[model samples]
Target: MSGFITALFDPTMPFVRNAALAGFLSSILFGILGSVVTVKRIAGLAGAISHAVLGGIGMALFLSVRGIVPGLPPIVGALIFAVIAAALIGVVSLKAKQREDTVINAIWAIGMSLGVLFIAKTPGYADPMSYMFGNILLVGGRELVLLAILDLVAIALVLAFYPQIEASAFDEEFATTRGVPVQAVFLAILTVTAVAVVLLQTFVGIVMVIAMLTLPAGTAGYVARNLAGMMVGATVLSWLFSFAGLALSWELDLPTGALVVTIAGAAFLGVAAVRGLKALAKRAGRRAEGRVAGQEAGR
Candidate 1:
């Protein structure tokens, strides 16, 4: 721990500072989007989008290496693939409810397959695991700037459309009946989530990043009174998990993305277990009270 702190403060290691910033910024997106995604019960949809980004990343790498599109950034390609994936999923969800699972699964598998093929055909050795399980400690200045911009944009959008988002999230049918444009809102959610998936994938790795997205929000759900409260709680938890995971991974030489997700998963599961036990205790107490009342009446 001391070593990690020392390294973090060392003037020579700017990347460490960038990485910490990245975690903080990434947590903001994870918290806001995760809350809505959880409420909407679209984690599966978000997961598909997260994995689909690999296809764009792979394509960008291939193009850049081949000089077909020299210096093509992976994020740009990832955005394209993620947006397309989201659009398809949104249509299937809204129009073909019965085929939603099938479509989601197809996109998940096909996107990954395409990515693998592209990486394989690239001239040089490009390890897919590097992209799939990114090292946050290596985050650069460009990424941090982009992340800040995304954070601002997301916050503004959320502030501007909270009512519509809240209405559409909980009860789509009711929201639609009330003239909420649920379809547009749903598609917009998917699109925003997809773009976030693209950006965060490069830093956190798409393989298990969904865990970070959902786990924090899921944990917050236990105690949060409302969606806004849940978002605030989730954001705090996400940042804590990210920082703790980053520190532990640095100290122990483990994968930062996996570490972050694991910590979040543990915390979420612990909270859930405690809540379940509390509920059971309440029910047991109620049953005991009823039995005691019955015995006293008979007596």
Candidate 2:
């Protein structure tokens, strides 16, 4: 037992150690962005962005397989295309003058279809399942560096613009009336969300990314009365889920992304149940009090 434990903790255990760290950092970053995404009522938009990355990943794989961009990294290509898609979504939604959900649905469909078609056409491209589900075990130093920089930028942006984000999220027109540059703030938030989606795609893939971004935050929101408390609680919950999921996946040989999302979903359900029970209890108490008051009045 001692020997096995020693081997498991050895520095030679490359993938497990590195993957654990990557998962931890990724969870923290995603949790923060997820809080903002939920509060802004743009959770659907975040989902759209995550799915849209499939198109970017497909395009990058095609270019690389064809040797058209032999020197360019697929991730770099994917990130570039994802950002462009995000910008286009922003521009179109602003110009369409239609319901935001309608515009987002159109963009989501188009992006996903393009990605599937591109992947179907590309020869020698790796399995699409890997992109859809993620490959955390394959994380390297380069990816970790990228994650670190993006995480720092995300944290800094949240800190610097907390008040503006709070105002805009709760009331856009009021924020604008207060000279908060609502449009600019919206654009900036969307851009950050897009980048975060792309980063999370590398770990959990598009299908599961939305769960990572929303579930923890959603659960946290139930117990949190303020933005700061919500963010902190969500981050803590996300980290717990991520670490537990990773460990469970390792022990059971289950899919890591699926396990992570499953844990988060369970947490969400648990929180909802607790909240519902409390609400029911409160209503019961009110009814009981009202009945007692009526009996006393009659007496």
Candidate 3:
């Protein structure tokens, strides 16, 4: 506790402060975007979108190394690629309907392959591990600023379209009857999710990014009465998991990103176990009540 307090106030440790701010912004992003992604039942699609950002990173790396647009940052490339991929996937899924999985899987594979090819072609030795596994310690002031902007956009959009989003998520036909533009809303949601996935990839990397997005929101779903409740619960959960993981990683000398995911996973499992036990207890109580009622009737 003493060490934690000391570290919290230490001015020399800019990385620690950056991580805190980034985590807060990230929590907000995950809260709103993850809620939408989970409630819409598009976790798999979101996973594909997250992985697809790899292609953009590779493209940026290749371009920068080859002296073609050397000023381009990989994150910018990722943002562009993510949005485009999201748009493409949304259109294909809307039109192909029955073959959506086939399309998503194809894009998933292609995106990963493209990333590998571009990185391999780059001049110097580039460690793909950072992109593959993530390192929150690398987050700087600029990334934090970007995260803040993205969080604001996500918050505004979610607030503006809450009713439509809620309506569309629960019942497409009903939402459509009410003139909610269900398809458009879904596409918009995917676009936003794509952006969030790109930003979050900086924290958790590509392979495990989907967990950060889905796990907290899914856990929140167990008790959340509405979309708003789910987002709030997920935001709190995200903040807790992020900071706890960061603290644990610092104390244990573990990989910060992986530790964060681990903490979130453990929390999710704990919630699931408790909920399962409660359900079993409820079932047992019902059976006992039925038996008691039968005995009383016989008496």
Q: Pick the candidate with the highest lDDT.
A: 1
lDDT per residue, candidate 2, 46-136, as tens digits? 8777777777877777777778876555566567766876787788767764666776776778777777887888886467788788977
Q: For candidate 3, lDDT tens digit of each residue in 86-188?
A: 8878988888878888878877888878888899999899777788768887788888888899899989998899999999999999999999999999988
- Please name the candidate that would achieve the greatest TM-score relative to the true structure: 1
The clash numbers for all candidates, in the given order, read 0, 0, 0
Give the TM-score comparing model 2 with the true structure, all chains together: 0.92
The lDDT for every candidate, in the order shown, is 0.90, 0.80, 0.85
Off by over 4 Å in 1: none
Q: Write one digit per residue (lDDT tens) for candidate 1, span 14-117.
A: 98888999999999998999999999899999999988888998999899999999999888888889988998998899889999999998999888888899
Any idea how many clashes model 1 has?
0
**Which segments of candidate 2 are over 4 A away from where they belong?**
1-8
lDDT for predicted candidate 3 compared with the true structure? 0.85
Q: Model 2, 296: alpha-carbon shift in Å?
A: 2.8
Q: TM-scores of all models?
A: 0.96, 0.92, 0.94
